[model samples]
Target chain A: MNMLEVTNLSISFGGLKAVNEFNLTIKKGQLYGLIGPNGAGKTTVFNLLTGVYKADTGTIVLDGQDLVKLSTIEINKAGIARTFQNIRLFKELTVIDNVKVGLHNGTPYSTFDGIFRLPKYFKAEKEITEKAMELLKVMGLEAEANFTAANLPYGKQRKLEIARALATSPKLLLLDEPAAGMNPNETAELMNTIRFVRDNFDMTILLIEHDMKLVSGICEEVTVLNFGTELTHGITADVLNDERVIKAYLGD
Target chain B: MKKLSKSTKNSLINYGMVIALYVVIMIIQLCGGLSNSMKGFLVPVCIYVIMAVSLNLVVGILGELSLGHAGFMCIGAYSGAIFSKLTEDTITVAPIRFTIAIIIGAVFAALFGALIGIPVLRLKGDYLAIVTLAFGEIIKNLVNVINFGVDSNGLHFSLKSAMDMGLAEDGKIIIKGAQGISGTPQDSNFTVGIILVLITLFVVQNLVNSRDGRAIMAIRDNRIAAESVGINITKYKLMVFTISAALAGAAGVLYSHNFSTLTSAGDKFNYNASIMILVYVVLGGIGNIRGSVIAAVILYILPEKLRFLSDYRMLVYAVVLIVVMLFNWSPKAKEFKEMVSYKIKGMFAKKEETQA
Candidate 1:
């Protein structure tokens, strides 16, 4: 069953077609990959799906709810959460606090209750802290829960982003270049972590990547985007082996 | 009871510090060590401390520079003073009357905060600062021309002069244009100011540690990432901005009530006053609530106390200001302080081992 379905997604900036005629479908438990050369609009597609940019024409259906008209915050409320290409953790906040911020919408308490420390404040905050700790433990960051987000090592910061996104309890998780600045060992560990999240959390993740090894190693199915359009989509092996994809990444 | 979180411990320390300060001041007063001038500085110091901490919310946590903070204070001052002037006879009880005045002022200020924040919060960086600066001036000037009167008939308002309001003989002018409001019961004292200070501290410090505070600080740290994680940017920003404004208004109520005559005619609520409050936040170290409290107290009392060295008073004051700013903010100073603290802790550990 499809968890997220995007049809005819297109957006433009100053007459430049950043993303054009984009279409994607991800099954409920499948780990999907979005790959393209530099400037081929992979991030733009993420922005479109996440409502960072309003689509000029398209429908984004996630779990049977249309999200084209929703704002970025509302889109996340509809069970879609995203991480940035460049790590966007709340740098000043502690590791666990970053996750608690993600748990914000999930746990509801009025600002009044918080300021005055009403009975509800203690209950809600206790619930939120416990939940955030669990997510941190899942990401193997429970030990560093009190460390500042920026103080964590590079690979661990990326993991923190994943942990934070998970705190929101989204149905579809979007990862943008999760292994961009990591060593080979970290990349290997990240591949295992991604698979583990999929199995444990029952998450359907869509990611954009330039590392073909990471893409081919973990992705069940791949969609290749070239020049703001879908060049090919199929099983990972077949799509990565396509001659046109190689040419698009390399030369004419 | 369960173990406390690190943040909760820090908050407890801050509250303890405020209580300690209160006890020390009260002790000094009881011993009759406080001078006439020192006692005079007491309530104003509390007022400025409240102002500094409230402004810190915008400049530090909210990550927005607001130059028009004094405008909200002006609103609170006038509204509170006017209320007190109108209800002096009906509500003869001072504490109850003052509490109601504060609530009225805070609410009145919060409403204006929402009004100005809608347009002002939309701007960024220097534009936000410029607009807020303009707003501060506008509010001060606006209050200067307002003539408000209350009579047996009803409340009366005029932009021109008190005579234009056509109030009856029994009616009293609450605010007489440039004269402002006079003869309002002086319900604020050093003790009441300290209580308000504690209340402000409780509200601000607790808000900073709460879940909503995390969302607010998240927006400050990274606006885009916050939104991506499902945090509503505008809602949190406006909410914080309004709260900060309301707190400033509360401070204004304390300020106006302490004085027999309350007026915005001079530089009390001017651009300079706004900038002075900002200086307290900055010198105290932005985002440090405890530091704001200390900075407000010291900076306010330093100049007044330095009257003995009249010739070089401001010069010495300037040096102290720079020293405090550097000590609180400079990286080298921070490292040195941390190293010294570590050394002290290590000494205690060695002594404990020796005792064992």
Candidate 2:
């Protein structure tokens, strides 16, 4: 029932190992968390998972498809979608259009269909608009669908990124610091949104976060990483309470 | 896009603007308000409009700088001119022949655009601009050294000269070295020019408002985010780049036919020519397709009309550029314009409500 199985994932920059021997497994529709301190290669692990950085040695299998050596775009097409640690919304595009860009692969019409404005173009576009709107409404952003993404409030921008990621309709969603700068209330809202997406969209999420409260609140399981290697991982409560994980996070 | 959609509204506005310009020109012609010189300027104006609009695709939407746009234009002009020159005897029908020539120009320019885009688009930077700048210079110089001819033995070409072509005694040089192509059937007219402008507008605007266009702009806005969302960066970038080049080719075909002789010398396919088109795109509000059309008309016509400004024509042109830049880009000016437009819309809404 595993949707994503990654083992022995490794990458290096020069002589330094950025992420080494990373192993992760997420069951279908499970919520997972990856927590690590600064310079501990959490984002690098996300990059490795998304094929942004080709793993030096590892096997990433999503729904029985081998993901290694695939390009970032191909990895996405293989059902792995990610959000950046820093919000990377298409800032100038409208909120709905950003989601539609994610829905680009699902667009049934060709460029020719679009250029000629054929009947199929109209039909396909209507479908795409409705679908993108559906995703925005799920993210509670229907009202600001026409607003440019950069103009959105910070909490809303984070939600927009999640909406865009869901537009890809991937089984496994990778969120890197989704609640990075949110206030406490926004973080609580995001936790609920994350759970809502996982339940309603049939999505399995693996997030990296520094916010311990958010991680423990929604994560079914947690993995602690330090200095390019796993510190420990288990049930969310146990991992958060582990002495070594705490020492790794805040040195004694 | 569906009817009354945001993009649909923008596209209708763009199409209406171009159609309105066409109507205005026709009216001036009917009233004999157009002087001979002004009449001569019509096709050139359309040509620049097409060029600016197409360039905006690359510079504005796709967010790539292309300095070699004129190189593609040169390729289009020469390829189109060569086809027309050789087919002068067989394709006696000017319309069919010119249509084929435009297609040839577009294809060749697209071929080169893809050729250059493959290497440059892979790397993220102003590499495209730098390489294209060099490409424009090289293509211009390259045309000068090319010699082309036709004879009983078929087509012959050489880099040296007409003598090096070694054609049959009955041969005629279609493209003599340094002289470029001559005797190309001048099938271009203002009506045709405007029609082609409309077609180019239709293609570029439609592309900008489509799924592919959204992907392209996403890549422009954030390459990493676009990649994560499954948009193929190279494919979309190259697609827009090729389309832009092809439209420039069509414009080049129109331009070459405007002249009795087609040559690479002067501002026709030089670096300055490419920069001039870029200026229109930038001053026109980058991704604003309709703005590009207006900028091309005003910037192109102003200097000619202001030739009456005597020695200060260029000075006046510089001032006009500053004003246009301010009007198009200054945030305060943008806010003011938006406020005015809102008021105008409100007035219309109130009138309709009262009538209701």
Candidate 3:
């Protein structure tokens, strides 16, 4: 069964259609890429799917759950987690605490349990700490778990954002410009990390990227967007070689 | 027995310091080292500590500037005072009555916290601050126009004049406009104040270490990221705000019960009072709970202790404030403080290892 399906997704800001009639379908465990030039509304698609933006017209079904009317937090709980175009870590928090924030929903303790430090609070807190540490270890950030996030290097900060997202245990992960500020080496490393995440977690991913190399490297399928509309979509190689895709990137 | 974790050990040390300060004060009191005036300030010091610590939950942990904390304090003080007055004859036990009054005050303040938080929490930064300031002013003004009395006929209320209350001839006026509540039972003592401070610390510290607390700090650090992580922003925001306000209300109960006469005046429960609490939180370090406690105690007593300085007392107090601010914010001072704390922690760890 398809993990996610969007039909006729549309949004407009002051008569300019930021995203219009956008449709997408991804089977379980598929690694897909949404590539577009500036102003193509790639991020807008992610925002709409994640409930950050209210769609003018559309239906977003994730694993048979309608995500349109839900809030951002509800959509996230419904199994869609995303990273940002800009790295957004809880800068003052320790790296592990940043991951713990993602694990918040999974814990079953209440505010009273927390205030009183009930047995469940301890049990759940210990489990969360273990899980958060495991995520940090997965991202090779175990050594830096106690460090404040803003103190980390740029590349590591990006990696931490992904780790934080993965900690949410989403059925589908959305990456918006995950490699925006990375050098070639960091991008290459992120490509491997992304592949590792998919293989180990058996999770589906939808990535938005302006970097052609990074997108074509790991994506099994690619969707090209132009002026908030889908231009073409196919296997990675075919879409990259399409004449329209080239013109859209280079500007006709 | 299992060895204590580093974080747990650190927190134990923090609590130890608070208890140690209490012990020292007790010893000083026994030895008659404190003047009667200083003894009078003791309960108020504990009250202020509770206020500062509770406010930190909002200003520091939740990362929302609340200038209307005094408003919650006012709600708590008046509600608690009135509850005690109405129950004065019924609840013969002093401690029981005081407990019920504190709970009533906290609940009432928490309700107001939820009411104000729902609308203002949607706005961020300076806007939140200004709206909360307005809330404080509104509450203060509302109290001034409020006139109420309680008697065998139950409760009577009026917004205009006390004469308009239309109560029985023997109806006792509980609140008389700007004059506020008078003849409130002074049932609170240093011990009760200390217990309340410890309770506030326990609740706040435990929350800070729990999953909910982490979520609160996450929202403060980055609201968008917190939302994307499946955190209910409204739920957590309201939870923290209500809890913080409730604790402030508890402090208000302690304050009101310590005095026979209580008024919602500019000097007592007004905008400046709110700012004073915020100053304690900031000077203590925004998210530092222990710092808030220490800052409140020291700052509250500093001016009184410097009374011997007389004419130059406030001048010295102003100088001391500047130095503390610099120490907190300056890079070199921060490094020095970190080094000192690191060394202290290292010493404790070594001692534990040797004992093991």
The candidate maximizing DockQ is 2
Query: Could you tell which candidate, 1 or 2, scores higher by lDDT?
Result: 1
- For candidate 1, what is the TM-score? 0.98
Per-residue lDDT of model 1, residues A1-252, tens digit only: 999999999998999998888899999989999998999999999998888889999899998999999999999989998888989989999999999999999887898899899999999988998999999988899999999999999989999999999998999999999999999999999999999999999999999998889999999999999889999999999998889988998887
Weakest lDDT window of 10 consecutive positions for candidate 3 chain B: B5-14
The TM-scores, one per candidate, come to: 0.98, 0.97, 0.95
Model 2 interface DockQ: 0.94
- Model 1 DockQ reads 0.89
Q: Sorted by lDDT, highest first, which candidate order results? A: 1, 3, 2
Q: Positional deviation of B69 in candidate 3, in angstroms? A: 1.0
Q: Rank the candidates by DockQ, best first.
A: 2, 1, 3
Using TM-score as the yardstick, the better of models 1 and 3 is 1
Q: Pick the candidate with the highest lDDT.
A: 1
Ranking by TM-score: 1, 2, 3
Q: If you assessed candidate 1 against the hidden native complex, which CAPRI class would it receive?
A: high
Query: Model 3's A-chain: what TM-score?
Result: 0.98
Q: After superposition, how far is residue B337 of candidate 1 from its true place, in Å?
A: 1.1
Fnat per model, in the order given?
0.88, 0.97, 0.89
TM-score of 3: 0.95
